[model samples]
Target: MILLLGGTTEAKEVACCLEAAGMPYIYSTRTEVKFEGKGVSRFGALNKEGLECFCFTNRISCIINACHPFAHELHHTVAAASLNIPKIRYERGFPERAQHELVHYIKDYSEALAWTENSGFTSMLALSGVQSIPHLRSFWQKHRCWFRILDRQYSKDFASRHSFPADYLLFGLPQEKEEEVTLFQKLNPDLILTKESGLNGKLDSKIEAAIACHIPILVIEKPELPRAYKLVHSQQELLHLFQHE
Candidate 1:
């Protein structure tokens, strides 16, 4: 049986392909969401040993790693466990370089916050998720920053627990470029903070709005993946691997 580590859009597409091909596999997710896909599924996380054990016990012939690009720790776990197995690292590629001059790419949240502090951006709009809120405590305390987060219970509870200003917590993801522009105008932020989520992240729309409003963007670059793993860019490539092996 194949083990498909899924969560992203590419993973869903791969799932559809697998279902169509009548492939026997198991889908794994880190979070507890309603998975409307086929095949058996296992929820929650696993350590390196646990992952290897699962692979061995379930007889996972191959692994399709379709987790979020930002999930670096999970990637490492997958890499370590799949050393002796056929593993496919599926990733949605990010741009080689930022197109706009105003786009300042930083290493992580801390550096992004530091950039904001150094740039004197008092009012900042953070498109990065709630997980990053804790790291930006000092920045939030100092500046009038608003966080755009998902409208989920855990998100709300975490924000509340962290003492993030209720009014400053904007729910829902940005949809279109025009919506982003409207949001930018409404916020009137001096700078915007976001992560490099690549094409799947709606990065272009946010960048377009930032460019239109003349607001500088502080982008936290994606984390590095493991070196010794077979990597694929698209669903087609992943499907090809499954077919061949």
Candidate 2:
């Protein structure tokens, strides 16, 4: 049996590839999501110990990691747990950093907050997701900021627990460039904040919208993955791994 850690679109593609190849696997996600793949679906976050125990009990032969790039804790846990198992990381292709004068690439959330503070960007629009609310709490609490997150009850509950103002919350993902332009115009923020989530994350639309509106945008770079796991960027590369196994 194989263990597939998934939650991203790339994960769905990998599941499809696995199915086409007639491979048997168990697909796992941190939370319950709507999945229509053939693999046995399981949900819940797992620690290093739990992962190892599960793999052992299920007779897992290989592990495919197709999680989001910013899933830092889960990536670390997977790296630490499956030392003996062959682990393959299905990575997303990140675009080259934009060289526009209005675009700034930040290393992480801490540095992003500092940049905003030093630059006197009080009113901002954040497209970095609900999980970032706590990370940037220091900046938002002292200034005017709006966060765009999934229009789900869980996301709202998360914001509530963090004491984030409900009125400042925007629901749903960024639309087309024209719609995004309208959003920027309506909000009229001092700056725009987003992650280096690659094309799949609609980074280009955000960049274009910011540029069209002449709003400076701060992009948080994706975190580096552990060197222990082998990385494959396409479905073909991921499927190739099983051939040798």
Query: Between which residue pairs do clashes occur in model 2?
Result: none
**C-alpha RMSD by candidate, in order:** 1.7, 1.2
lDDT of each: 0.84, 0.91
Model 1 alpha-carbon miss at residue 81, Å = 2.4
- Best model per lDDT: 2
lDDT of 2 by residue, 26-112 (tens): 999987888899999999999999999999999998888999889999888988885598988999888788999999998998888
TM-score of each: 0.93, 0.96
- The C-alpha stretches of model 2 lying farther than 4 A from their native spots are none
> Best candidate per TM-score, number?
2
TM-score of candidate 2 versus the correct structure, residues matched by position: 0.96
Write candidate 1's Cα lDDT for 180-206 as tens digits. Answer: 999999989999998888878888788
